[model samples]
Target: MSQGGTSIPDEEWERFLREAEAGSAGAPQEPSARARMVTRRLREQPGPPEGWRTYRPARRRRGKGWYVLGLAAAVALLVVALVPGLLVGWFGGGDGADAPRAAGETQRPDGPPAQEAAGRLPTPDRPFSGSPAAGWADGTAGIHLPAARATGWMSRSEVEQALDRTRDFLAASSLDRAVLRGERPSGAMALIDPHQSDVHEFIEKAFRAPDRENDPLLLFSRFRPSDVRPAGDVVRTRGRISFREGERDAVEVSTDVTYVYPVVRAEAGSEEVVRTVVRREVVLSWNDPAKDRVEPGTFSLVSYKVDATNGGCDNTYTGYFTPVFGAERAATGAGDGAVVDPYDRSTPIGERMREAGDAGGGTATRS
Candidate 1:
């Protein structure tokens, strides 16, 4: 019905029905009631003015919608890729969760102090335990062998300084002038406390040879510092020197050390001929620091020979030196004497020619 409604005749309605049927029969089936209703409403709307109502085709849009969709997809993919990495960082990785505790800690379920754990070493930053009185006794027995002769061991600092001096002495026949005065005499005196006093003294005195003695050329000079360091109190210092004799080289060496407290002293002498080493003797004693004397005890020295040229040998000597004997020997300058510089002319007529001609054994003569 038009906006200006007017009743239509029955004949006009019949004619309209006939035309709709003809249109349906000529093409597809007729529209349903609802579709027809929608079509009539659209047709009834007022048309554009004048001839402009004729016709106009629709145009497709080319806006940013497609680009926006592509951006959304890329952002989704990036999120998927980074999520796992972010989670791992927030929580610890596999390694952190499974790692074992560091060595030095107490392994018991009720963990004790970290320093006491098995196989763990206290860091350098930590302080050493209580007094060093018996500290050296437990950890470094090999350093002071033969309990009877074990006394004064060297302090770490003392050993280090002595080694430094040795290097300087070797370079120039003098101690580092900046550190000490005068020429570095060819003798080494690394003295520790009473604990190992006898050992130190014995070593200092034992490593000497008269110029007329069998072997003249003292070839090698070296110090081997071991890791089995004294905890405290007792200390150790080792020096090795080689003397050339015969076709083979006879090495005279000693590790002079002392054990403090119940003070013990030792001098371990070793001789190497060819490729074999013979532990010549080990001197030991109990020391009385107050009196600056070795107590009333017996010290001993053993001699052994090894023939490495044919493989090895087993010839060992066993003996002991009593306190009385040691005292007598010391008096004669055989047990504890002023460090002798073989190179020193004052060493006596017999020993003068045995002196090292120069700091470096680079030059040699039969004096």
Candidate 2:
């Protein structure tokens, strides 16, 4: 097959080993079955839709200097053939092969290049210098190369302000929004905003059973920011979420956020040193006390508290919610037996929730 005046095989699998080895460093592990099929289809054709591109393996080429050397070698071979005395002298250990002797003289016991042709040395650790997936056109559009690691020190106030801006943004905005926009403000306003009920609905839908319909109404009775403290070059805020019991098929409404900002050193001729904010986020096990109830009628507002912690200090917050659910597992026993006890689940939930914010928590679910 002719592609850009170069011959390409009709079947990729036929030369898969060679191509894969050549591209081992620059591409992701081989795609899975569905992805492979999609790639194969696109490879057989040409352009794809706007958002997608046809799979094209990256090609590596020798440098122009090496090409020139190759041409020179070919010309030298021609000259040597015309002059038989040179080849005979080279085999007979004459000065004509002095360059090869000098090259062999540089060989070492454990050196990588010594094992191969000196001019075609293998890579040390990885093969390619850059990966197509990690290039500018990839998702990291505005990311500048990380500046040199900071020396000197950052002030406590500077760290606080950076932490505050990131915290406020995460608390107020959705993570999807924050990641897309590449910024978040420092405050719990986002977490406390009345407009965030859709977030709970989205969480519920994520866990609902195929046979069961979910109409989750999350009422955040209390949302508060307890404290903020400087830790290294970042500031951590501890908070809580509490609500009344309400109708939820399988709701997972937990929130944890971390923000990282660059520590700028005082410079002579720099306007603003932009610090990249890296957020460490967490989503605790959902607290569902008002689950499948016996009565289809209204239920009292049960409290659900998220004891979120940072480091060793625990910050607790409670809220009230009244959920309504259709009659399905209305039987007095729905959950996995005594594990359904309110106090039992509540105690462990609080303790583990605190641990979740500190050390990542264990997995538990109410089905």
TM-score of 2: 0.17
Which window of 10 residues has the lowest lDDT sum in candidate 1? 63-72
lDDT string for model 2 (124-173, tens) is 12111111111111111111111122111223342223222222223333
* Backbone clash pairs in model 2 (N, Cα, C under 3 Å; residues 3+ apart or in different chains), count: 26
Candidate 2 minimal-lDDT segment of 10 residues:
64-73
lDDT of 1: 0.18
Candidate number of the best lDDT: 2
Q: lDDT of each structure? A: 0.18, 0.19
Best by TM-score: 2
Q: Taking the tens digit of each residue's C-alpha lDDT, what string does model 1 give over 43-107?
A: 23221111000000000000000000000000011111122222111111111111121221111
